[model samples]
Structures are given as structure tokens and as C-alpha cells.
Target: MSFSQFGDKFTQHSGISRLMEDMGEGLRTSGTIMLGGGNPAQIPAMNDYFNQLLMQMHQDGQLSEALCNYDGPRGKALLLDALAKMLREELGWPLTAQNIALTNGSQSAFFYLFNLFAGRRADGSKKRVLFPLAPEYLGYADAGLEEDLFVSAKPNIELLPEGQFKYHVDFDHLPLNDDVGLICVSRPTNPTGNVITDDELLQLDALAQQHGVPLLIDNAYGVPFPGIIFSEARPLWNPNTILCMSLSKLGLPGARCGIIVADESTITAIGNMNGIISLAPGSIGPAIANEMIVRGDLLRLSQEVIKPFYQAKVSETIAILRRYLPEDRCLIHKPEGAIFLWLWFRDLPISTETLYQRLKARGVLMVPGHFFFPGLEHEWPHTHQCMRMNYVPDAEKIERAVQILAEELEAAFKN
Candidate 1:
């Protein structure tokens, strides 16, 4: 059997698929230490809140309506209106329901946004999505319908004290050329947890505006809600900025809700896509979140419960890594936010791919770093020696996993 170019491009084995498969196997297989995947930690407090909200919605008959009816492609009007009101009143961003569009998930939203801005153009020209930093989200590597749809620049590696490092946007050599149509980045970036400074973001925004492109900020784990960011970061949006948020990290992945805050034109484009694709975005997440927004519980829980939970987990995981991993050989990216800790095994004898296999054999699972460097045009040895570990697992399990990781690293170094 054969498939079209689109089918072949999407159906081919990819990094995101491997990550999901590993995550699924870890969930189903007993004793598999799940330090892979982007699944947010199951915070009991958040779970309890959701359970209570579910009961309340059920009693009020809101749950049935959400499940049975179809919202417009623009998404639940109430949720959009509430979100717009909150952002306008609280954050002082001029917005309305027209500025917001919801998709089934952030991943789907990215697919639409990427292809919308980039790829084959109407004039037979090709445009690419510019990732200001190289080691971006793995899911983005294959989002484009056209081949070679992304270009990236290497980051300035700032080596911090105590076996830590940070990635800074190399503004000196950013690839903001004519061929680029959109600029995108994930704040509290996945896999690395590196939060680009507010000034850095502003500079990017200015650059994007100058280049006549939209700056897309992936806030799946960022401010206002699901506030998993640990460092100081001011939420930013404007007419030229596209801020994408998700309910997945806020203990609602199954609900598959994604939010895009953009200008009216972009939202209309996304709505049209939604109408053609899924007919409409799913309603359950928006339904629950809308209630939370009205009661002011969404930001409260994110700030009070969600952020603290992940902060503690990150701290504990770092401490465990320090204890188990060889301090002189392993360097961890300074975990500012997000649920992951990026580990760079300095000059390991084997690639992280081999190390991943070795660790998986010992009942540990993690994503190799190579998968994260999409659109990187040059070869950098650092990419092969790194991996991303989800720190949301239990402390004991994480400790055991770190010990196994240390052992594997030691063996690899010796070999």
C-alpha cells in the first residue's frame, strides 16, 4: 500500500511518536520508571479540586451539555469571553472573544499554526518557521506539511556553578531572514526548563515585528494558569504575538484543550482550520476551566498548588541527581520551570541513545537529547551527550532512576 506525500510525512516514525510510545509503555508496563514524556505530575490537591468541580458541574447539569453539544470552531464562547476579560482587566492586554481560539490540543494547534504561516506559499515560494533556539520541542520537528520547514540558531551555553548550565538566545546570529514566516518558542521550554528572560522575549517580539512575522509563544506550562514556571517571567502578548496555552499541564490532558491568543485575523484562520479539521474543539476542558476562571480558582490553584508542587519536585530531583550522578562529569541545565531536567553528560563515551537503551534495560526510561534539536543545521557534539528527565515522578523512584543513570554513565565513560 502507498500513501500521499502528506500521509507519508506524518506516518513516518518520528521523535514525538517514540516519546509517546515510551511513555505509554512506561505507564502500562510494571516497574518502568517513567522519566520520559511530557505528562504533568498528578498532584493530589489539583486532582481533588477537579473531582469536586466535576461533581458540581454534574449537579448543575453543565457536564452533560459539555459532553453532548458541539461548540463553534472558535470554542466555548463563555470560556473565551471569560479569558479575554481576565487578560484585559488583570494583565491589561486589549483582547476579546475574537482574540481567542481553542483547538483540541496544543500539538494540533501548532500543526495548524505552523502550516498556516510557513511552508509552500501562494507564489510558489517556501517559508520556514524560525526557532530562535535550537533544542526546541520535539513535536515541532514534523509539524510542517512541507519538507525542511524549520530553521534554527544555536544557543549561547552559559555554564553556571554547581554543575549547571543555561541556554541563552544567541541574538548575535539569529536566523531572522526573508524566508522565515513565523517565529516560535516555548517559555519554560520543554526538556530544558530554560526560561528566556523578559528582555530577551521583548527583543524577539521586536525582531518578529520588524520582520513582518508573528511571534508564537508556547505557554503550555507558563503563566496565568498551569503556572509551572519557577523563575520570574512576565506574561507577554500583543497584536503581533501569538501566545498558546494548554489545559493538559493543569491536570486535564485527556480533555485536550488548547488556547491561542492572537489578533482577530489569526483567530479566524485558526477557527476556519478547526471547522475543517475537527469541526470544533473539545468542550469538557473549556467548560471546567471557565467555571474556575469565573470563581478565580484557576490562577489560584496554578500559583498556589501547581507551581509549588513542580518546584519541590524539581528541587528534590536535582538533589538526587547531585547525590547519584558524578558531579564532575554531569552538568544539568538550571531548571527554571517546566517538569523536566536536562542532563548533559560531558563527553560521555557513548551517545545518549545508547545510554537510554542501557537505562531502559534497567527499568528506567528517558528521551535522548538528539531528538530535541530540530532544524539545527550544524553538528554539535553536545546534542548527543544529553537527555531530558521528567522530575515529576516520586522522589524514591527518581532517586533509584538517578542511581541507574549514574551507573550507566559511569560504564559508558569507562568504555
Candidate 2:
């Protein structure tokens, strides 16, 4: 059976599922060492917290009300208020319930922001959005496409010694137009795992203000890992800035809790849009998230267990890369606070897609850089040189996967 046509806007779109399909097929047949996804190792806290929430509701004889009640589109008051306090304490950002809008996940927060701001010009022309090259998260491009906004990505500018693999945003070289609506960047960026400096954020804020546009920061990986240090938020430099955060990376994706904090006008606009689309985030989701923060389980777990565990894993993975791969042949980024590594095969002769396929054949897998680009073919002609690898897997898996990846790279280079 043929499926009906979607809207014209969707014609040029490709979802993450398509990218995953190729990787999944390889893994299914070859039992490959998979590292393409950015999912955290485990979120047992969320599972336990959710169970406790259910038990409490059942015992209180409020299970039906808790599960079926429609909450305010803005979110449950308790969660928003608790999050406000957490934000102020954790990131030192002054906020309140009126400034936060809860969504299903940070991904939904991106969607809401795009829809809210990516409207046509006064002449009915589409606006363009700028994104960093080789971005850690892939959903931002998808959201931009869904809203019919053009996406322009600058090269991943390096900011490290010898400029080998460090990535930064060069605002001066960015192609800014009057039709540009927003600039989306991630703090402690995904895939690359590099953090933006305060000066860089300040410059970006200045640029956004000069253009009279908003800057959206995806802070999915800003929490301090064991040994690494990174900036956690944009210094209160721009009132027009919108910070999108998720509990997913911090051990609560299942809580389906994410937040968007902006100035009052932007928050109200997004809250209204969310009401029209999602009605409200389910009541229980916010309540459990609120409870986790209020009762101190979330903070305690993040500080005590999650931070050290992931930090060690990341450190170990970097050591393995240093041991197995040649320093000049393979380019690597030392991440400050995220779970993935961006590897560029500068000396390899093969394309990234071909290398990815070869690695899958040899019992390994990773995301080719092309999938992160919005219009893949037009925008990522040189993507064959790059791939994003996750280090959040178990120690045994990481060791095995890194060995396989190194072996595949050696073979690819020899060929």
C-alpha cells in the first residue's frame, strides 16, 4: 500500500530512523560493536524513582488522578518551581516557573522553539537557522527542516593546541542574513564533546543581539564529569537567549522531562504553542521529576554515582584511543563534559560511509558525519572523513569496541 503524501515541507526531510536503519542492519547481521547512538549507559535512578511515584500514588488512592489528569500546558507547578530552584542553585541562573516550559524531552523543546521562532519574513519568505558544523546532537537539523527553515552550518573551527581536532564557532565568518532567525549551539557539544568558552558565548550573544535574533543553547551535557571541567550555562549576557535542557543525559529520559528557559515573552509564546500541540505534558511525568529534585534523589545521584562513573569511562576511552590510534593520522577531541568523541580520519584514503561499512563488517559501528547534516548530500560532501563514537558503553564493551575500531582503521589505511 502506498502512503499518503505529507505536507510539502516534509518532502526534503529525512528522520533519524533512516540513518539508524543502515547502522541497525549492519549490527543485526554482523553482531557489530555498536557506538553510533548517544544514549547514556543506564538510568536506574529514573526507573526506581518512577516506581516509587507509582506506589505512592496507588497508596494515596490517587493513581487514577495522577495518571489521567491533564496538567497545565506550562507544566506541573511543582516541577517548574522546583526546577527554578535547581537552576538557580546548580547553574546560578535566576529563573522562576514563568520562565520555564516543560516538554516531553529536550528534543521537543527544540521543536517548540523552532516552530515558535522560525516564521516567514514580512514578505512571506522563509528564515534560515545557523548550526555548528559536526554538531554533537542530530535532532536540531531535523527540527529546522520540519519548520521549513534553511540550515547553514559553519565548519567545526578548532580551538586547541596546533588546532588538530578542537572545534569552535567563528561568528565573524558566519553567513548572517536579515532572514536569519536563530543560532543554535550546544554547550559541551555532542559528538565532539568540546565545551564553548565564556568569551565565545559572549560573542555569540552579542551577534544574536546585533541581529535581533535568539540564541538557543542545547545543554544536554553540561554537568561536570569526574575529572573534566566545563562551563555549564551562558553567562547572563543575553536576555533573548533560550536554554534547552534535558534530564536524559543526566539519568532521566524516561521521566520524559525537559525544560526551556527564556525571557517572559518567549516562554509565554512557546507555552501557548505547546498548549495547541501537546495540550500538556502528562501530569505524572512532571510530578515524578519534581519529586526526584525535591527529595534530593536527582542531585545526590548525579553527584555521587553518575558523575564519577561516566568520567572514568570517558577517561578510559580517551586513553584507549591514544594507545591504539596514531596521533597525527587520527584526529580526536578531548571532551570536557560529554559522553562521545568525534574522530576524524584525516590520513585515511576511504570515505566515512565506506569506513563505517567496513567497520560494521569487522564487528564495529559508528555514526558517519553525514547523518548530522540537514541536506546531507549538498552540505556534507566531505563527511567521509569524520564519525562520532560514544564512550558511554560498559567498560568491557568500550574496550572491545575501541580495539575493533582501531583494527578497522589500520586495515582501511593499509588498503
Candidate 3:
């Protein structure tokens, strides 16, 4: 039998699939230094805290609920209550348990949202999701069910005095047209680690409001809960916005838990979708994370422990890059937050994809930049000249990977 369009689209060998496969297999390869994945490193304090909690639950015979029983499509009632309380107390948002929904992970959450707004609308015209940042998350490239369902505006590149760069939304190029079904972006962006400022977010919200479209914020690596953010960009929520968050970065990716908060109607739609698609969301992640949220422990731990851990890693990695890479030829995006650093090689003799293959042969792994540019229409040279490296690996691994990358760059330049 021939496969349907949906099957074909979903089964396609896309960048995201290759990335995930490589990441999963790379960890088992003893010699390879993995600098490509978005996986969060295990932190001792946080791991201990959660392990103790789980042990306590096991001791009290309360582990069965999370392990055996399936929760509602909206997820565990207690977890929902805890999230509601957290949002209400901290952000002063008029949110309740009814306003929240849970999913398998932020990836599944985005799939629902992307399909919810885009694809076939009431009219014959297919509406599209608009991303304000071009080189956005690689996961988003295949999230949509429909082909050509995403459009994006190129960012205004701001080069600093140092060999650093910033990516800002190019408002002049952003379209406020009827074809757009929604606007979406990742806070503390995935590939570049550029956090979209409050003013920029507010403006995007305003534009969405004006166009009667919802602005979706993928907050998987943002402030408050996981609190990976380093910049001044604070977490936000409004009736005009939809915030999707995850427990992955909090060292719970295995639990496969994600949360979504939005307008009541949208929340209901998402819940319905979750019910139909996933039967019910996973219970364990929210079960553990909710307690952390309610007790205010998650925020404290992230701010005090996780933030500093990654920050130090970023600092050391940046220093190593500075020492190795030729300053006149290479530039790195100043990492505001997140696990990865974006490195740009100016006028490289080969494509970043080719460089990725070379690095793979040399026992180093990194994501090529071109995979992150699916939404951008124009051919931007910068997109082909960059790579994203995660600095969360052990110091020795990172050092070795950086040195290999430096040598690769020199060789590529000479060739």
C-alpha cells in the first residue's frame, strides 16, 4: 500500500531525525566527544534532591500513581494545581489549573501548537506559522504537519566591538498579513542563544494582537522554572500569548513531561488534542517537578546551582575558543543562556555541513547551521558558515573537541 501524505511528511529523513539519532548513538561511542546534543548534564544537588523525593514517595507507597496510573489529558490534578499556584503567586497572572495542559514533551507540545494554528483553515488558503528569528530551533523545522507551513524574517545582525554578534528581529521584514496563523519563537533561542528582549516580545505580542493571532513562546530554556536564562529577559504570560515549557532541562527528559499555558479556549483545544493524540500525558515528570515548583525549590536550585554551572562552562569554553581560533577569522555569538554556543567561521573554504562531517571523522560532533534555516527564504551566506557547539560536556571532552574544531577550521581555511 502506498503511504499517505501525512505518513510521507512525518517519515521523511529530516535534520531533526538525523540529529537525534546521532546524539543517541554518539553517547555510547567511547571515543567521540559529543558537542551537538541539547541534553542537560546531570547536576548532583538537583539529582540528589529529586532522588530523595522519589525515595520518600516510594517509602510511603505513593509511587504507584505516577508509575502505574494514567492521568487525565490535562495531566495530574495536583501538579496542575501547583503550577497554577506558582504562576499566580509569582507572575500575578490570573491563571488556574484549567488554563494549563500537559504533553509528552516540549517537542510534542510544539507539534500540537504548530498544527493547531497552521495547515488548512476555514478558507482554502493554508495559513502559515511565522517565526521572527530565521536560524531558530532545528526541532521546529519538521514540527509542522504541512509542507511550506512556516515563514520567517531574517534577524538584524548586530556585531559588537569584540568578536561577538547579536540577533534581533527585523521588524521591517516581518509581515502582518492575513496568511499568518500565528507567531512563534524560542526565548534564549536554541542555536544562537540569543534571548529575545521584553520590548521585542511585547512588540511581537502587539503585532499578533493587532492581527488577531496568538504569539507562541517556546520557553523550554527560559526563566522562572528551569531558569536557564542569564540575560535580563524575564518570563512573561498574557491572554495573547501561549507559553510552552519542559522538564527536560531540569534533568527529567526521560520523564517526557511538558506544560502549556494559554488562553482558556486554546488550552481546551490543546487538551482535546492531547487526549486524542497521546491518550494522556506522562505523570511522573509533572509529579516530581510540580512539588519543586510549589515549594519554590526549582527556582532557587536553578538560580543558585544550575545557572552557575552552565555559566562557568560557557565562560571556560569561550576562553578556549578565544585561545585557539584566529580572532580575525572566527566570531562566536555571546551566549546569553542555553547549553550551546554559536560559532561563525568567516569565509570558510567549505560548508558547515562539510565541516560537520570532518569533525565527525575527527571524533567531534556539532550541528551544522544550515539545518536551522528552514523558514528563511533568502540565501544568507552566514547560515552556511556556522556551527553550534554545546559546552555542557566534561572539561576534557570540551577541550579536546575545541582543539579538534580549531585544527579543522585552519585546515578548511587553507584548503
**Candidate number achieving the greatest TM-score relative to the actual structure:** 1
Q: Count clashing residue pairs per candidate.
A: 0, 4, 0
Q: Which candidate, 2 or 3, has the higher lDDT?
A: 3
Cα lDDT of model 3 by residue, 129-169, tens digit: 99988789999999888899889888898887679988899
Pairwise TM-score winner, candidates 1 and 3: 1
Report lDDT per candidate: 0.92, 0.70, 0.87
Local accuracy of candidate 2 as per-residue lDDT tens digits, 255-314: 677878898898888778779889987666666666667678766766676767777777
Candidate 1 lDDT, tens digit per residue, 1-415? 8999889998999988888888888889999999998888889998999999999999999999999999999999999999999999879999999999999989999999999999988899899999998789998999999889999989999998898999999999998899999999999898799999999999999999999999999999999889999889999999999999999999999999999999999999999999999999999999999999988999999999999999988898888898887667799999998889999888788999989999998999999999998899899998998999999889999988988888888787777
Return whichever of 1 and 3 wins on lDDT: 1
